[model samples]
Each structure stands twice: as C-alpha cells, then as structure tokens.
Target chain A: MPKFLIWIAALAALIALPHGLSFSQQEILVFLTINVLLVASYRLLTLTGEWSLGHVVIMGVGAYSSALLTKKLGVYVPVSMLLGGVIAALIAVLLSFPLFRMKGFYFLIGSFAAGEIIRLLWKRFRDPFGGAKGIKGIDPMPDFSVGFYQFDFFEPTSYYYFAGVVVAVCLWILWRIEKSPVGLTFHAVHWQDKLAQASGVNVRAYRTLAFAIASGFAGISGALLAHYVGTINPNAFDIDLMVFVLTWAIVGGTATFYGPILGCVVLTVINEVVLRELGLEQMRPLIYGAIMILSILFLPNGLESIVQKLTKRRAAGGAPERSPAE
Target chain B: MLDLLAQTGLNAVYAASYISLVAVGLVLIFGVMGVINFAHGELFMAGAYAIVALYAGLNVPFFLAVAAGLLFVGCLGLLMEKALFRPLKDNPLGGLVASIGFLMILQALAVMGFGVRMVHIPPVTQEVIAFSEKVRLPVARLYVIIAAIVLLSALWYFLKRTKFGWALRASAQDPEAAALQGISITQTARIAMFIGAGLAGIAGALTAPLVSVNPHMGHSVIVTAFIVIIVGGVGSLEGAIVASVAYALVHTFVTTFWDGVLADIVGLSLMLLVLIVKPTGLFGSADRA
Candidate 1:
C-alpha cells in the first residue's frame, strides 16, 4: 500500500474506533488522542537534544491558563484553548533563557526545578489558581452539530471525535515541521551543537523555537484534557505524569516520530485495557515497572528498533531503501 | 520573635541533617556510577518500612531496628548494583531508567506489603531540650542531628585516611584513570552504592518516628533531595551538604513565616537561581554536570 492509502486507512480506523468501545473506553480513547499529541510534542523538544522534565508542567500551564480564561474571563472555550497554547509557548520562551544555559543532566534537573516552582505557585495562590484543589467545574466544549453528526460533549465518543480531529491536524503540523529545514537544524543541534554553530546554525534560537513549539502543542493537549475531564489540579500535571511521558518516549524509542506514540498507545492499552480488565489495579505499577526495566535491559533501543528492523528486513529484497529523515 | 526564630533555626538544623544524608548519598552514587538514582528516595522509604516491620510489627528494639534498616537497605543497594546499575553501567541513561523502574517497584511493594495508609512508629523518647521557654528541640531531632554530624565526620575521615575511601573518590573523579591505577571499578561502584544507599537508609531510619511513613512518602523526599543536590552542585559531596544546610534554613524559615507551598517554591527558585548564575552549583565546578 502507498503512504497516502495507509494514512487514509489509519484515519478511517481512528474515526471508527470509539464506536466499537464501551463508554469508559471511549473516554480513554479521547485521552489517548490528546496524549499522542503530548508525546509527539515532547519528541520535538528532544529533537533539539534536550529532554525537559518541565514539559508536563508546561502542559499544565496551558490547562490552567485556558481553564482560567474560560472560567474567570468568560472567554469562548475554543478561543481560550488556543490562547492557552500561545501563553504556554510564551512561558517556554521566558524559561528558555535560564534553562537553555545548562546542558545534559543539569538541564534535566534545571527543568525539573523550574516545573516544581510553577506547581508550587499553583498550590500557593488560591485566588486565581484555586489553591491546591485547583480549578474545578471547568467549562466543557460547547455542543455543536455538523451536517452529518452531533457533538454532545457529554458523550465520550463525541469528545473523542472532536479531540481526534484537533490532534490529527496538530500531528500533521508537527510532521511538517519535523520534515522542514528547521527540523534538520534541530537534528544537527542535537548531534553536535558546535558543528551546527560553525555551519551557521543559530543553535540557541533553534533550541528555543523547538521548546516553544513543543510547549504550545503540549498546552493545547492540556486544554483538551481540561475540558474533557471537567477539572484541573496541580497534582494532575505532577512528576508522575511527566514520568509516564518520559517512559513513553524511552520505551517507544525517540529515534523516530512515531516511536513515542506507539509506546503511549501500547502502554495505555496494557495499562487501561489489559490491567484494568484483569482487575489488577494494585499490581499495575508493579507490572509496569517490570515492563520498563525489562525493556530498557533487553530492548535498549526501544520498540521502534524492532519495527525498524522488521521493515528493513522486508525492504531488503526490494528496491534500495531510503534512510528515515530522523 | 527571637524565640520563634531560634526554634525555626533548630528545626532547620534538624531538616538539614536528613536532607544532607539523602543528598550526599545521591551525589555519591551519581559521582561514581554516572547515573542519578531516582530510586534513592524509595530506598529511604524502604529504610522506614524496615523499621515499620522490625520495630513496630515485630517489637524489635528501636535502635537495633534503625541499624537493621541501614543494613537491610544497604543490602538492597548491593542488589541494585549487581542487578541493575552494574549491568547497565555503560549506559547511564539506561541506568537512570532502570532506577526509575526500581523506584516504582519499591513503592508498589511498600503499598502491597504495608497498604497505602501511613504507618506510625512509637517514639523512642519524648524528651525535648529547652533552649528557652519557646525555643525547644526534641530529643529525637537531636538524634538525627548528631547522627548526621558523626556519620559525615566519620565519612570524611574514611575518605581522607582509608585506602577504600581513596579508591572510591578516585573512581568518582575519573573512572578509567582509577581503573588504570589498579582500582577495581566494580568494587568501588559497589562501595559507593553501599555507602550512598546506606546514608539515605539511615536518614529514613532515624526520622521514621518523627515523620509519617508511607509508600508515597518518597515523592517529596526525592523532590527535596533533588533541590538540595542541584543547589549544592551535582557530584559534589561537600556542595551537597552545604547546599542542604542552606536550603533547609531558607525553606524552614519560609515555611515558618509564610507557608509550606511557598517554602517549596522558594527552595526551587533558589535552585533555578543557582542554575542560572552558576550552573555548576554554588560549590560546584563546571566539569561534573
């Protein structure tokens, strides 16, 4: 099958997905859709050779910003969500000044400290942030109808469809950005900043750009989550969620764009569907931990490496294979 | 106001003691192995739970339980070295991920074995030392402070005077050079892991009666430790200790005057400031990070 046909088929499957699932699963699907965007955005940041522990908190910045906009300022829900992304991007630009000074482990810890400060701010200020309990009863996406279908917002399927379209478009933009010259600069920056700089690449500017754009998408994802979940809290964007994102990126392998998405989807299925159905709620973390360790130990290159290997083997007997841009 | 300040100062000292213990261990592990043990906090929790099992559940003597906590958690560190860190030695990122996995496993084990509820251990002593009418220090807090000083001083002596200590420091400073000098990297790694994990364990064991013990308790512990280590400068033991004291004083005073959340913000902001101004930390050199 050609690439376009494969994409169309995947889109059709995604469109048809929630209809076959139970109500709770439909809700999970909506979340999964949002997380795909979240992880994909995180990949963009990693493209510039930096892993931010603050990414989830930046997502929270979006959720909190959008939630506050809608709840306090009475802005339109959709407009607030977009503004939320913009605000998150703005915050990333500001944070980049202090954060981009450090590299490697220092950057990791620096980002984490930056994120904690934000979360602590949320907990300290109850006036607008609603204190530790966070903003509750966030406005949902207003119900609307297209010619062929109605979106009730109350129904998970409807929310899934709404979120799915937004995520698909966001993913497309992210894909385009990754394939552009800027993306190549990001890769160059990742591999060797000095070389990229010598070759006339503005390393810092590209790093900041990737950070801002990734943060923007993450914010949008957070906004989608806030509306669907009907609430937002400091705890919601805590380090645990960050760890999950990190796990997704690592387990799926960050070598390719689809890697983290594949990891997120697969892990979500196992965690939500398999573990939940097995009634092993208590043991979920235990099993997940084991899986993480096993994968790192045995499949250090990630699940994507396996996929890459299989694809390479298949393509070996065919025409010469082109290396992935990644 | 003076009395309150004094009391808060005493509290800060107590806080600094445990924080430094944890931070030092973390720094030690990172220095030698070149991987941050995300599970360090969980190791502390394990130490607390060891007390819960031995002292609270089985009626062991408090001091003996504390000792057992140290040894048991130290052995757990050896297990980590043999199983996780040693195998993934070449891959620091992999080691980090593995430590995270170990952290989750330890937390889950705690939840399963002891339930998610907080466990309370009986106080070994109810005595409070009164500096003044309002300025008082609990005897238990003094125990932590004393242990921190004695252990740190002894560690200093060992590092300066002992061959193994020299070996450990040598490996931490430059692993290949240390190995070329006939020091076994594996042995030094084991020693560092043992001491590092032991320090955190002992901190948890000493403070078990003072703080609420639970599976998720490690979360905040880890956060505070991270802030301390970052502010102290990564891979610098002296820096970790000094930063822990500085952070504790600032945090304790902030929490006293303002609130707990603000204290956390202040601590984190202090770290960010250090990163921005001196990315190597207050006492750190540029090469370590």
Candidate 2:
C-alpha cells in the first residue's frame, strides 16, 4: 500500500471506531483529533525555527473567515472552509517579508504584535466578524451530501469522524515533509541558518513558506473547530488562545513531529477532564503557568527530549560524559 | 487644534513614561541574564495589586504603597532568580519557559486573591492642569513623568559611575569576561532581576489607578513591552528606552486622535517599518536576536 493509503486507512479506522462511543468520549476524541491537526500545523513552522507567535491568530483568521463566509455569504461549507485556509496562508505570505528578517525572539515578538493587530482589526470592524458579540448561528455541517455522500456533523460521533479525517490528512502531509528534502532544508535553516545560507539555501524563501504552511494548518484547525462548536468567537484567537496552542508545542516538545500532538492531546484532556472536575476554571491558567515554569527548569528540552534521554539512560546504563573539542 | 496637539503631547509623555519603565526593565533583565522574563508583566501586575491591597484597601498613602510595591516585586524577582532562573541558567529557553509558568502562577494567585472584576482605585487626585477645557493633564500623570526622569537619571548615573553599577554593566556586556575581571555573575543576576522587576512594579503601581486593575491587566502590558523591546533591539538599554518613548508617542497620539484599535494597528505598523528600514531599532546593535 502507498504511504497515503496507510494514512487514509489509519484515519478510516479512527472514524469507524467511534460508532459506539459515548457523547462525551466522542467530544474528547474530536478535540484531540483537531489538536493534532493544529499542533502539526504549528510544528510545520517551528520546524523552520521561526517561533511564530502569531500562529493562533492564523487559526483565528481561518475560524472567523470560514465562519463568517458560511454565515453571511451563505457559501458552501466545504468551499468556505478551504477558502478560509487559503486566505490565512496568503495573508501570512504577504506579512512574512517584513516579519521574517528578525531571527529568534524578535521574530516571535513581531509575530505576536502582528497577531494582536489582527485581533484588534477583527474586533474593530464589526460588520464582518460580528464585533465583540461574535458571529453566531453557524450551520453545523449539513446532512445534505455533495458528490462524496452527505452526512450529519451535528451528531458527536459523525463530527469525530470528520475531525479524524482532517487530522489524518494533515499528519500525512507533515510526516511526508519530515521525510522529504524540504524537511532537510528546514533543519538547515533551524540548526545552522548562517551555514545554510553560505551553503546556498534560499533561507528567506523557505522561512516564508514554512510560515504560510503553518498558517494554513491553523486555518484548517479553525474551520474544523468552528464547524464542531457551531460558533466562533474572536476571543478564541487572542494571546490567551495563542498561548493555549503554544502550551502544547512547548510542553510536549518542539524537536519532532509527534511532540506537539502528544502535548495537545494530553493537555486538552487534562483541561477537559481534570480541570473541570476540580472546579478550577479560574485557576486553569495558574496550572498552565506552573507547568511551564517547572517544565523549563527541569524539562527544558521538553518531554520528548526528556523521554529520549531516559530511554538512552535505561538502555545504556552508564557511560562517560562525552565532549568534543570545540 | 492647539488643544488637541497639546493633549496628545501630554498623552504621549504619559505613555512614554510607563512603557519606558517596562521596556527598560525587560532589556536590563534580558541583557544581564540572557533570559527573557515572560512574567515581567506579572511583576507589574503584582505591583498594581500591591497598591490594591495597600492604598486601595488599607488606605495607605499612595506613594508609600508604590514604594512598597517596588520593593516587594523586586524581592520577588530576586527570589525567582535564586530559585527558578538560576537553576535554569544553562538553558535560556528553560528560564523563559519557567517565567511563563510563573506568569500563570501569579495570574492565578491574583485571581484567587482578588476576583476578576475590574477594581477602581479612587483616583489619587482629581486635580488637573488645564491648557484648555479639553486639554487637561491629570496631576497623577505628572507623577509618572517626574518619577521617570529622576529614576532614569539615577539609573544612568549608577550605570556609568558607581563601582557596583560598572560591575553590573560589565557583567551584562559579557559575563565570562566580567567573571575574569572579578565580577560575580550570580550577584549581577540578582541585581538585574531586582532592578528589572522593580521598574515594572513601580510602573504598575504608578499607573494602577489610571487603567482598569484586574488580574488579567498584565496581558496588554506584556504585549506592549514585547513590541517596545523588539523595536529597541533585544539587548540595548538605550535602545529600549528610545524605542519605548517613540512607540508610546506614536501609539498614544494615534489613540488620542482616532480610536484605541487603530492606534494598535499603527503601533504594529511602526514596528514593521522599523524592522524593514532598521532591524536593529533606533539605538540597537545587532548582537542579540
């Protein structure tokens, strides 16, 4: 079977298994599925070493764009969803030229500032995004099937399947990049940008492309979220939201493709299950912040790296600390 | 038109004062420690809440509360360095991530201590100096400006003249070399944390009454600080101050004439323009990213 077939089959299994799942279980599955897509999308950018802070904003753009188009313009849901991702990616590309120059934290800061600006813009223009009140009454995925056969998305299990499909496709795309030449270039830009530049990499172009791809994924996630939740709020795309997405990548680890999905799924579950039970709605951020601090101090390289170290330690038992002359 | 310009000028100066305080601290901490304090805004929030606890609740003198706020938050910074940032010194990202955690902890504590509703501190004074009926300068704003001038001047003097100040600057400029020259990196880190967190605290204490005081107020302040520092360049003290003043002026003036949202747009556009024309900022050198 082709690699794409494996991806499709994997996703199909995920979708089919939800047939007998409970409502709450289905919701959890959908959220986790969407988070995997979202995190992978974000990983696409971080893989290039850009540290794009505006990533949540790109998701916001996607969520709000598709949500608005479907609500007001009455466009087909699938097309609007695709359009949302496309618009967000296009905007990211246009903004990337001015933003991509500053390396490291400056790029992060610039992207953050841009995200704030976009958020304010969305809030300021009341006609389109429904102002602070937010656009409501989005039609959840309709049962009227197109050529692919219609299905009901309002039911929790069906939505999970929808989410699962998207996640599968995104994961495939991301994994392919990881194994491809572009992934090699991404490492070149990340680990040694100066050396890569000297070695004839179009460092600027690649960074821009990475950013656009990341934004595109965020858009895809946003669309999925809007369809699932049936409403989109501007508040969902601000710093808090941005930080929410970032927590996954940071806590899970940023060094590999699997880390962010691991982070998103773990945290999202914790948020839904443990946090709600504890009645710590107001203190959720406190928990998040504390985790961040402890993670930095003890797990600086993040959980993925930590796991690798542990596995190596358990496997090797003991070895002399190795250092090469710099 | 005259009144409008003068009003904008006053607003600009006020914005410049607080933002410069926050930005300068951010730079100082980043310079010395090689770690960005994501919780710097939380320090500012802690300052404001120090006032909320003291001046607003206990009816302490405003200036006294402000002083206490500075000292308390500065001490908190020292504690953070000793406990958190110091252990993670080998990993700057670790330090930064730890700070982010601290930011959440602080926010949570604030929420638990004080509910999330906006707390209105009775204005320190209602007195205003009038250029015209609409062109009024609140006496409270004058306090921020005067305090900025005196404090910044003293900081400059200390940085340029005093032996400890020289040690601090030396350590900031190059820690390994400073260590070779007999300066202690650990001591310098303590000093930087205290000074940096103190500035943010004081800025917050002074401005607490002007804006809505809430647990989440640190959000915008940090965002503003990030923009200022990036515009000022990562590691330049003078650049941080200059960029802060310039950004505040443009943002405030635009906010005053137009709306708050548009001003934000313009503030970011200014950042973009700076990045394009002078990526190092107005007074920045390009060593730190």
Q: Pick by TM-score: which candidate is best?
A: 1
Give the count of colliding residue pairs in each prediction.
0, 3
List ranges where model 2 is wrong by over 4 Å: A1-28, A144-151, A306-326
What is the per-residue lDDT of model 1 for residues B182-223, given as tens digits with 9 covering 90 to 100? 999999989889999999999999999999999999989999
Docking class of 1: medium
User: Could you list the CA RMSD of all candidates, in the order they appear?
Assistant: 1.9, 4.0
Enumerate residue pairs that collide in model 1.
Answer: none
Fnat (0 to 1) per candidate = 0.75, 0.75
- Residue lDDT tens for model 2, B1-289: 8888888888898989998898889888988888889899999999999999999999999999999999999999999999888898776556766787788899899989999898889899998998788899899999999988888888888888999899998888778999999898999899989999999999999999998899988888887887788788778878888888888888888787788888888887777677677877777786554
Q: A219-282 in candidate 1: lDDT tens per residue?
A: 9999999999998999999999999999999899888889999999999999899999999999
lDDT of 1 at A13: 91
lDDT for residue B176 in candidate 2, whole number 0-100: 90
Please give, as one word, the docking class of candidate 2: medium
Candidate 1 has an lDDT of: 0.91
How many collisions between residues are there in candidate 2?
3
- Candidate 2: tens digits of C-alpha lDDT, residues A122-225: 87888887777677888687765556745677777777766776777877887898679988798778777899999999999999988887788789888888
Q: Measured against the native two-chain assembly using Cα atoms, what DockQ does each of the candidate structures obtain, in the order listed?
A: 0.68, 0.56
Question: What local lDDT does model 1 show for residue B35?
Answer: 87
